[model samples]
Target: MTTEHIDDSAWISDKDSPVVARLSQLISALTNLTMETTEDLQVANYGVGGHYSPHFDFYHVTIQFIRRSCQIFCFRSGNRIATWLTYLSDVELGGATVFPMVDGYIVPKKGSAAFWYNLYASGEGMIFLRFIALN
Candidate 1:
């Protein structure tokens, strides 16, 4: 994906995991966003030097609109306003969720998660106000 820089990921269904389902619900209520706010749970693995480059979640700009074949075949989808990522495993090294501009980061702890809105209250800018480094 253009926004995510990672080696690989496996999608996990919340329905198959009670913990994930509950976390999704909690995030929906807490953020005042729908449960749809949660992307599919992901089981991601990293090898040597694995890391995700900084990126934003929501669609920022559109290239064009209503092209002939493109628009005719396309279906609308919701804009992502936030992200919910919970770690299902632990990394002894090089695992963290970081807000670089803020100089903040969370070392991985199994079952811990990181959540944040992608936009400002005005809905016009990044809410966290910086690059969030997920590695």
Candidate 2:
């Protein structure tokens, strides 16, 4: 399976607009996570045949160590514990989120969202919980 990493064209914060603020609030409430623990909102646009290869949302052990050490002094949140993906548009053709390990597949629909845990309750990354997107 080929892999591709495309940076999001836009990144919006809650403070940038009321719409994003409301979306952030909804994400927080749904995930049961505080705003401080969440990252800024990202918007990615995919054209025909676009795709995202399988990947994990949480950091690796070494990166987690560095991040945790930094967080001790910087007072920032640790590695990602969960992901809440909100679909802003519907796809007429192929656009689906897939989790191969667990045989999970989610079709894109406007105003719909998918949520999943990336880490265990003990803060360890769930290795089999990787996902991919086909567009």
Candidate 3:
């Protein structure tokens, strides 16, 4: 499998998923923002007693991003302005997305999503977890 800044189960290119179009349309309509391209759909599988420590969603950018495979379609330097974390499965126990700097964390459920800007004034974020926007 192709590896780089992230370590998870596997990723499928979002190019062919019908859900991608639907999601993009919904997000655009709701937020009044235009999305440019679809990134790979990462499928994160949690093994028995599996865990990922506190982590940041968007990683630190190196000086050179022009040659990175995960960069973009148009070949431009990328900055993470926003992030969408969608939970495909229900987690009854201990899986939660947490931000150490912002004092924020989320226990995700199936069909539920959390959207947050990757950075903020205090170097974190104000997340919008679907229904409720956290500030």
Candidate 4:
């Protein structure tokens, strides 16, 4: 799987498209919170036969923390943000991102989206955004 890091200052410059602009607005409205407005957006593309296997978002590797771990850190650092997955297209058969632990699942809807928290005040982190892609 591929991931990208968003900064608090680059969200506007990077998400200048009309659709993304609307999405950013929606995210702000839904959370009743403000973002640092950076751009470290991750754009992972899986083709017809490609898929991301199940995995936890954060983990401490031998070298350091992983990418998703940074996502957790950013949230804990006071972002008060949530993740919204806006699907660009719909597939007939596969590629749904699922969170088994939360008993929640997101089916991609073209031009629409899905959302969930990467961290919680109760101290749960990365359990809900576990990337489980279907084959």
Among residues 3 or more apart in sequence or in different chains, the pairs in candidate 2 whose N, CA or C atoms overlap within 3 Å are: none
Per candidate, the number of residue pairs that clash is 0, 0, 0, 10
Each candidate structure's TM-score, on Cα atoms with residue i matched to residue i, is 0.66, 0.81, 0.61, 0.61
Q: How close is candidate 2 to the true structure, as a TM-score?
A: 0.81
Off by over 4 Å in 4: 1-19, 37-39, 57-81, 126-129
Per-residue C-alpha lDDT of model 1 across residues 32-129, encoded as one tens digit per residue: 87775445766766555667776555655452344554443333544566677767777876777777767788787887877777666776647354
lDDT by residue (tens digit), candidate 4, 20-116: 5666677778877564553445566666666666665443243234578576765665442356666778878876787787787788878887766
Clashing pairs in model 1, backbone N/Cα/C closer than 3 A: none
The 10 consecutive residues of candidate 1 with the worst lDDT sum are 69-78
Best by TM-score: 2
Could you give candidate 3's per-residue lDDT for residues 7-115 as a string of tens digits? Answer: 3467654467878767877766766656665455556766445555443444344422444564553255344556676778777767667665556678878989877
**lDDT (Cα atoms) of all candidates against the true structure:** 0.64, 0.78, 0.56, 0.59
After the best TM-score superposition of candidate 2, give how far the Cα of residue 46 lies from its true spot, in angstroms.
1.6
Query: Model 2, 22: alpha-carbon shift in Å?
Result: 0.9
**Tens-digit lDDT track for model 2 on 12-79?**
88889899999888877776788775667878877677777777787775643555555563356567
Give stretches of model 2 more than 4 Å off: 1-3, 6-8, 62-77
